[model samples]
Target: MGDILAHESELLGLVKEKDLVAAFDNGDQKVFFDLWEEHISSSIRDGDSFAQKLEFYLHIHFAIYLLKYSVGRPDKEELDEKISYFKTYLETKGAALSQTTEFLPFYALPFVPNPMVHPSFKELFQDSWTPELKLKLIKFLALISKASNTPKLLTIYKENGQSNKEILQQLHQQLVEAERRSVTYLKRYNKIQADYHNLIGVTAELVDSLEATVSGKMITPEYLQSVCVRLFSNQMRQSLAHSVDFTRPGTASTMLRASLAPVKLKDVPLLPSLDYEKLKKDLILGSDRLKAFLLQALRWRLTTSHPGEQRETVLQAYISNDLLDCYSHNQRSVLQLLHSTSDVVRQYMARLINAFASLAEGRLYLAQNTKVLQMLEGRLKEEDKDIITRENVLGALQKFSLRRPLQTAMIQDGLIFWLVDVLKDPDCLSDYTLEYSVALLMNLCLRSTGKNMCAKVAGLVLKVLSDLLGHENHEIQPYVNGALYSILSVPSIREEARAMVP
Candidate 1:
């Protein structure tokens, strides 16, 4: 106890000193680890009530600090060693506390996983002292079980006398309860309902429970088939479509994104051995439903005027793809939706175009069916002759070029002619508009077809640059200059610049 007090005093003195926290900031992992080790070790040994609480608090604080700093290239060996030591320390202290009813709360504290990695520590500990700890422990173990590939922990649990049937039963019961509670809680927090695995587990339990309650004659495979058919039928599609516009920015879209936020692929649950084949078959057969959901989700990406909504929509689209096969024929329905609503889908189309340059080139090609491009061409307005919203327009143009550079060359020629006409408009030549227009033109000029297309756009670029040279917005000036520099860097545009100088 005296040694523990001495260490606490030392920690306090260290905290009081100038720049103690700066040791963490300076990227000195060893010092940060040592500070945490000493504090945690002392607290564990002393077992002072206040010190025990402080120990848990500091463990979390230091763990988060270390994780945040050590994100790229963490010291894995050192981290494992520290975790082993910490776990050993906790076990010793927990064993001591288990001997006394008064120390049961500390048992709860020890079980709370570090919150930085697992944010549900508080909830996990909610019934820790109740008779339901075994159930809660089972849920906790199951959650981690899905994440753990190694069988060491499971083997240990089995050796300790936990039966497979008990484990499975506990999991099944916890999921059943979680589903019931989630429905009630979702009225206030919709995100809990949107989580894919949570929904899957709950739905599976509902099906199982329903099956068990029915008479043996009524529980035939054909009956089960009819039930699934009804559940995923077109009526449900209409119901889902009307319940919330997954396309319009709303609570549902937000909740869906929160639920499907990426987890490490390995951490996601492996398909159960029995259901793996059925899962694949269901995914293949249910492609149409997946397509509808994606299209509606894409619409939310389009109609959402807010930047936050736009970002979330992009992320959700990525997540939705994880469940559906990328090359599935049902993707055509999504493209058809995009084609049918070209004007309303402009923002999402533009985003898709930009994304293609990075991650979705094949999807962009598949999506830009001739019908979609024709719709885009039809939507071209006289005002677009000047490249207002040119960044977005150019992104779309770039994708079209990628899809069909030869066929798009003529369209490019026509667009450039309009760009020159718009650039020559005194009223259309403002700093903001010209900056975006010139950048778009520069992007176009960089394209292979746009090489031959550059000569015609050069006069407009030179005129825009000359006007922009005296603009007052310092930010706009650099961008305009950069665009001009890019255009001049091209051989044809360089000749145009020289021709004008002479």
Candidate 2:
């Protein structure tokens, strides 16, 4: 069909010339005219073989030639007769040739496929319908077309050298590109919207809670305590994360970068430090939270380096102001914090007191004031107190026992008996507790008074020390060996040791 259309268009293209130049000198003129004339005559005869083939441009060419040349012509008589017959057949469609009241479907050239004779139509009715049925279906289609007043199909115009399909494809591509950008913006928009909504919800909930709290409705002391604790924890975590103490030389990143010479940077301390006077003042007068923070700061200062010097400097204050009297605390001594509700304060005080009692002069100062020692002993006896706080108390007592005066005081306080009873169950204690207990027990037993206290429970003390002999910790082993050797000085304890099976 495409080849036929191309050939027909080529013929019509040269039909403008006098002798059909497309088919004559450049093409065959006689052959095309012969075929066209025979086709028209045969189609007029009975719509035979010519009816099966469609020559659309030939019919149009035939009408155009006669209209342009209206004067005399060689084919004028035949053309007139053929035009007269087609005028009646075509009616209004060929109105220049003829006119009528009704429509006509015969405005076609010979060899043109009318609805019935077309191959597509023939195939549809091949075995299923007779020739009579084909005519009836064609008539039905024509009647429907007339009733609906359907017009011939029109072609769409091109735009910017692009066909409709090409234009549609470009539009689709543009839409796809827009969708790509839209998705990224949409995700960001949704995230921001979710954050905004979540903030609003949290604010509303906090407002309702505060309102209820103000009215004293549905609130309990436990709830208030938990909220306070949670807020404190949040503040502490944020403070720690953003802390910028920059203690010591060569510790900060900036300090290391400033060096022109190659140098190894030191490990930063676990907590930051401030000037001694400021720290000392804050520790004594700050709120519980501030004091908790200062406690850790003080621990770092005292333990890291030059601890004896640090201990002396700290002792100078206590000595001049006196150990038990007020260092300006509403007449309450700074040392009274040993009994404070905060576990951190108690623990650091215990550790700091232990550091103070490490030296002979500091131990003597602590001995003059037995209140600190008694408080430590009380803390050690409290089973439900914080484990670390109690451990530090035990450590402070151990430090005090290094002095003869403090050792005699502890024995007179019956601490030797208490230590022996606790060490009897050493398996239940932490490594630090067991180590400190053994070391303190050894220090006390070095004296005659501590040995006498052991003699009261000689068999129990012998067995406890014997059981500890097989302990895995080598650090505790020295303390264990020393305590055993010292306590056996008592004749009763020696007899009890000997009586035990090897």
Candidate 3:
């Protein structure tokens, strides 16, 4: 979390020397791994001083390297377990491993044994000893003791030395926060990387489960469904996607691609079976539990299994040209998931809703049940806790404004107020957020309800619209112009707009 310690040159130098790692590499691995285990287990504890704590981290940094060596590769779980344990300690206290422990021997100087890690080299001196060697050994000991005591010496001499505790606490706090953020970013990177390749893993079944919360293990029904969002990099997600199928790209890109896959299908391929059922009996009567089951069956097939067949197939089947009894009824289930705290869950669920809203039939279904639409608006209106989720929510709401009914409903919920507020401080929003939010605003503003709503706060709306014209992104211009045209349509707003002119 800070600059590498002074001792890091030696540690990094050792890792970089693949030749050195190779030289130490051999048939017998138990000794190396065991020594690594013992040294790491015993030495990895909190230190009393900053320097001592730093030194301990240097040793741990080297131990992690030991596990990464190619030849004696232990079971990956062993590495994962060790690192997980190591990270837990780092998060709670700080990362460290004592250098003074009399475990794991090594040679730090010419025939000068390191009692901590280089003590094994001491045997070399027993057989071939010289007075000059003995003198050099005593000199080395003096230097080692002096080096080890430097931290204490600094503490004793420095003015206001008592501030060390305060400094350590602040530094450690910063290090911990920095480390937590770094780990979060790294995990997010892996997740996005994995998702980008989901289309390529079309042969896999989509599984969504968890092992640990790095991203974490799933305890839900989906915990082990089929994702390999594990610790390993490229290889980890790839293997899981192919064999276990733990994740499916929530985006429609994977759906479109996998729909063309060579997976097996029944003679009739049950999904598209009910699509053309024009018989009067085919219509959904009461709650249509059978239709719900059919849609549910197809939902998992498309999301969690190989593209056996049809998303559009299920769409058309579940919502016949004359029927949508099941589609609108399922909004309650959709709402439950929309309120999910998980970005993973919410993102995927949002995608499904996006699919639903893609067509006139789907839009009609959504209009009948504004609960899903309003839920999305509520989440977007709240604090921006997760960017991806907000992007998704904004994207969908932006689409919803295309329908006048949705526009009226959203305006009634005061969506225009929030949109204006967001545009007022565009710097905090991502480019995608800006684009989507602006686009949605323009669509809503075009509606009579949106225009009237803007009229109430025409001055603020005009200021936001005018300010956006100067924005760096050229894409928001069209939306800004449309919204300006809509806002200035009202007579009172038009009067105010003209009155503000210089």
Worst 10 residues of 2 by lDDT: 96-105
Query: How many Å off is the CA of 420 in candidate 1?
Result: 3.7
Compare candidates 2 and 3 on TM-score and give the better one: 2
Task: Report each candidate's C-alpha RMSD, comma-separated, in the order given.
Answer: 27.0, 42.8, 24.0
lDDT of 2 by residue, 22-55 (tens): 3322223235456444423442323432232122
Off by over 4 Å in 1: 1-296, 299-358, 362-374, 382-393, 398-413, 423-436, 447-451, 469-483, 486-502
TM-score (all chains, Cα) for each model: 0.30, 0.42, 0.39
Q: Mind giving the per-residue lDDT tens digits that candidate 1 earns over 87-148?
A: 34445543443344443333223223343334333333243322243243234324333323
All models: lDDT?
0.45, 0.57, 0.54
Residue 316, model 2, lDDT? 64
Best by lDDT: 2
Angstrom error of the Cα, residue 81, model 2: value is 99
